[model samples]
Target: SQSSVDNMSCPSTPSTPTSPIPYEIQIATEDDRESILNFLQTFFFRDEPLNSYLGIITEETPRCLDLENFSLKELNNGVNLKAVYNGKIIGVSLNGILERGWLGKDDPYKHGDTKFGIILDLLERVARESDPFKKYPDCEKAMTVKILSVDGTYRGKGIAKALMAKTRELAKEHGCGFMSVDCTSHFTACALKNLGFELHYSLKYVDHKVNGEVVLNPAPPHVAVTVYTQKID
Candidate 1:
């Protein structure tokens, strides 16, 4: 799933060009933590649909510690990757391994009243209902993209796609049988679809409610949270 607004690019496969895109996809390690966090603050924290709708980062509160923690919790995982151009991080894919009963095992939400917690609660619901593990019985484990985002200035140039492509390779190396992403934005869904991921589940904002109140009311086009998966052959 994407927590970044740059998914608006929804790029197609890169065509032959006069020169290369000037970026390289590389494994992200603990050393890159600060840079990745800075990149995310600029590219992801403010405009992602849920963050925007919930006002997770606002003028009064410029940062959300919980969200920051959630984003970086798996940063050191060998599967996480970043796209760097001119020595600057332009995109990142924070991935983690999920074993066969992950849905029923992990608790993704703890601070239910906090905006970040609320967002995680919704995602947990989506995962529980989708149950990707059950759908792909042969997949003993899978690599899940927790956060996928790209710098706005570098989008529409296939940076996000390149990051995902690299993530797929990393998944295979880690022995994952499948890979999945939850698309929190329509643009992200379109991007994943272009990369051949199958939509396994979706929940429209209008249909999700809390105490009879619709919790999310993002602008048009980002109307649903969707789960997409691809077997790693």
Candidate 2:
């Protein structure tokens, strides 16, 4: 009987669960900032060096925590999912726009006709493989799916998929057609692929030694993956 319970899926529709182990998904508010940070800190450091990439520290200051709050606040342009069980925050999902020209325009190094041509070629290749290009606002105009994270305690319970389905639901409601995410973990990538995401491009980085010195360089370029799903049936 206990195994049967594990096989059951949460209610597909959005609402608070009524059972004893109740769970609810709702919009995250400013008051949830501390809980959000605590949840993020759990996963932010699992990969050692990569955690450094996020600029997170074990001794987080109140100001740093506030910055996390600010980032979430700005992402209000998209869907933010918070899963609450027993009146405590247990999981979260943040998805929003990845605007076109946002990347190329921000990097001053890629200016002028030559650099523009190279970057544009890359963008075109990305656009060709991404499903976002064919949907609502067009992939080049805006990105639908972006960030998804689930708490550690709740892993292996299908919570991630539930949150993703909720994201797709929100994207459909917003009149957006496609979604994409840059995933670093193989588990995350494989899960997205299972949900119909495809690989578009991938670039590896290597820290190496050259001529008795050390250097960091981009590894051979590879394909990037894109996960695409039509929010509407």
- For every candidate, C-alpha RMSD to the true structure in Å: 4.2, 10.5
What TM-scores do the predictions have? Answer: 0.90, 0.59
lDDT for model 2 comes to 0.49
lDDT of 1 by residue, 38-96 (tens): 99899888979999989999999998888998889977778899999999999999999
Model 2 residue 221 distance off true place after TM-score fit, in angstroms = 17
Best by lDDT: 1
* Top of the candidates by TM-score: 1
State, as a TM-score between 0 and 1, how close model 2 is to the true structure: 0.59
Give the Å shift of residue 186 in candidate 2: 1.8
Residue 94 in candidate 2 has what lDDT? 66
